[model samples]
Target: MPFTDHERAYLDAQHIGRLATTGPRGPQTRPVGFKLNTDGTVDIGGIRLSSTRKYRNIRERPDTEVSFIVDDLEPDGPGAIAPGWGRGVEIRGRAETLTDTDPPLAPGAFSREVIRIHPRRIISWNLDPAAPELRGRTA
Candidate 1:
């Protein structure tokens, strides 16, 4: 798998993530609901997703490179100075715009339209205490 056990678990538990895509004007990012597919691909979808810029970007650029991140602040532990600890995983790879053929990531919450991400590289931080910070590797 591209993701470690901790990274996969974190992604499975999280409902929202940020997807970055390059468009005509510039780079754009938006909060998105995603599903970790059985094949280790990330699928992002939302209401009216087909009309969104991210979708257009993928459709327009056959080789659309994208980045996705799911993260949250970790509660402070004993002896912690402040409550600013963070943990998350980032997936960077190519994206494809899929329409009508795939099921929604969240039934009723998202449409059949989705942006499927094939991970080329994975970056994770603080997911496992034994793991190093900002650890990254090719998928």
Candidate 2:
């Protein structure tokens, strides 16, 4: 299922996301900061010019997957709550590198190109174990 407007907004509110790709060495995972657009596309930055492997892989194979956790889950501390409640979203999409102009990055940052993701499918789940009523809601 695809994400709804509300679910898309929830995903956009998140600051960090995980990107998964297949390289010559096999599965690769990296943390990234992303911007979600209203048109169901995602902009990902923080790639270095020298990071050719990831870019090459994505170029050769546009199919890719991304995941983001939307809930605020801080590990429980001595006085913190034991179980945290939140939701997570996963998207499968075709990735393409945007080359019209240099991506907006901080000065001296590694990545200058933005990878645009066009989502094909989206799945979401609430991580709270006690919240069975909220299960299986597609966003």
Best by the lDDT measure = 1
Residue pairs that clash (backbone atoms under 3 angstroms), model 1: none
Clashing pairs in 2: 3-139, 4-139, 47-111
Local error of candidate 1 at residue 58 (angstroms): 1.0
Report the C-alpha lDDT of model 2 over 38-68, residue by residue, as the tens digit: 6767777775732556566687666554433
The digit string of per-residue lDDT tens for model 1 on 1-139 reads 7888888888999999999999999999999988898789998889889899888988999786899999888778863322587788999999998888464476776777888999999999878767647899999
What ranges in model 2 sit over 4 Å off?
A: 47-52, 63-83, 102-111, 127-139
* CA lDDT of every candidate: 0.85, 0.60
Give the number of colliding residue pairs in candidate 2. Answer: 3
Give residue 4's lDDT in candidate 1 (0 to 100).
Answer: 86
